[model samples]
Target: MPGLAASVNTPFYQQHWQQIHLPLLKQRQTELWVCHLQCRVPAIAGNKWLKLKYHIQHIQQYEKTGILTFGGAFSNHLAAVAAAGKAFGFQTHAIVRHDGAVLNPTLAACQEQDMQLSFVSPQQYRQRQQSGYLATLQQQFPDWLLVPEGGTSPLGVKGVAELQLNNTPAGAADLICCATGSGGTVAGLALGHPQTAVLGINVVKDPSLPEQITALAPHQHNWQLAADCSGLRYGQFDAATLQLCLQLSQQDLPLEPVYTGKALQTLLAALREGHIKTGQRLVFFHTGGLQGLDGMLQRQRITQEQYQQIKSAELRLWHQFG
Candidate 1:
């Protein structure tokens, strides 16, 4: 099967103190208010069950289809491709970055989805967009169909555009926010609807993102990019960001520390600064990454004593109120 891991977890709304904490924080802010919009990506196998059923159906219509290849060891794209391959009877190959020494949760989930994984050097990985690299792979697996990394090809973008169009609320919103790893989702959303403004918060700390996004969308002007420099290093947490993540999660808007936490911070800051006006409805798109939170929390150096104190304080507060 060429799709995301079956064991891969999805995020759900749960009752937690973090959810409660956020509303209090919002109350502190005189200008900014928060609103959340939920959207679902394709399942592990790159199959958009609702819209892309026809495409999957078409793949099934062809008997000679062999393999589907894409990028990201821990990518939802990999999981989706793997699932699609397994369900539609196509071979799946995941070309991953060489530096990924240990299998992260997402990768583990992808493996569970039954995708064959291959690692390549960082230099070779850079050549992923080149025709020569793809040519070599095609020569090796003559019948394989190459799907670009993050599924950013025309077909993929089309399906993504449809998803964005369908999920966007009926009325006007001040901003539609999402975390951008590959620019595909943002690009598709930008293309589908021109009326609303789309803001992408980059989890990756690349300074060149503005140029990169512009290259991907040269003519589009309504799109904006907000980089999460708080997590200066990838997969590493900063104290302030972790605290914010913990607080936001308590607010009924549980945000993953890496991407959404930074986004929430940016959104709130924008609201406080009057960047976005009051009564201007904003919609935040939550791209799922709950597994990453566990990895981040595990890396924290907090001692048992510190954890106990925090827990004790929280319990005392609850008891006083209740």
Candidate 2:
């Protein structure tokens, strides 16, 4: 990232784009607007950018030179941290929640970004929040700024709050929807726009998700969390989820299970169950997780070649990373 080609510019901050005329949007009869946050930055796009938006600012604000964060093998947060550290001139290290030697595309890509990897047992990873655990890390890497798992710091909420909803769908949205990871994005969004109902479709089966997001939100805004539509749970999908992923990908809406797909499935199920009113406009945020797709495919025992053969129709545009 440091001395990268000039023509290969990836901006840390850029203007958001609004896309319209997608077929399903019309059929839904809603003023649907999607912030193509994926295109905002090539590496740290979508909620990853928002999550790290203020973390980077915090590091710079404190005049730090190193960063430390936590994640699993397929963590989007870890990937973003690695990319941000390389692009913005910081030493980055990832405390991965895995044991033994693990070689995968996500970690490989992080290495390509010049991120240092440290493998830890799942139990140790869970101790990330304990005072003594953090103190040990502080003693080990005294200069590195420690970021929580999923980058869900209070600063992260502030970064997500900076996202301004465009006037195009400004007052028209009856329900603003997004996929929840660390719950920072939804908290920031709900705090930023308190009037609209925020329906956050959670990927994991955690029951405390709502309380967690509510506690993080600066304001107790109108919001709801849907945990029922988890389809085969996080990182595990069934025939229905695969079908939905295929359907959305064919429409140029790439998704991964940990976030986007579950949100989409929840929304569609809501519409089908008549939980949403006929005239209500549902603004779905496409929080990009294309980076995790290949990892999920491999975890499902499908090779990249097999996925390519299946999505041949959508391959051309896939190169664009849309």
Instruction: Identify the runs in model 1 with alpha carbons over 4 angstroms from their true place.
Output: 1-73, 87-89, 164-170, 206-219, 229-231, 294-322
Looking at model 1, residue 268 earns an lDDT score of: 67
Per TM-score, the best of the predicted structures is 2
Tens-digit lDDT string for candidate 2 (92-137): 9999989553678789889998899999998888898789999999
How much is 47 displaced in model 1, in angstroms? 12
Q: How accurate is candidate 2 locally (lDDT)?
A: 0.72
lDDT by residue (206-305, candidate 1, tens digit) is 5766665566556778888776646476555567765775554343345555666676676666666666666555666555444443334344444444
The whole-model C-alpha lDDT of candidate 1 against the native structure comes to 0.55
Model 2: CA > 4 A from native: 2-28, 38-41, 99-101, 169-171, 300-306, 309-322
Clashes of 2: 0
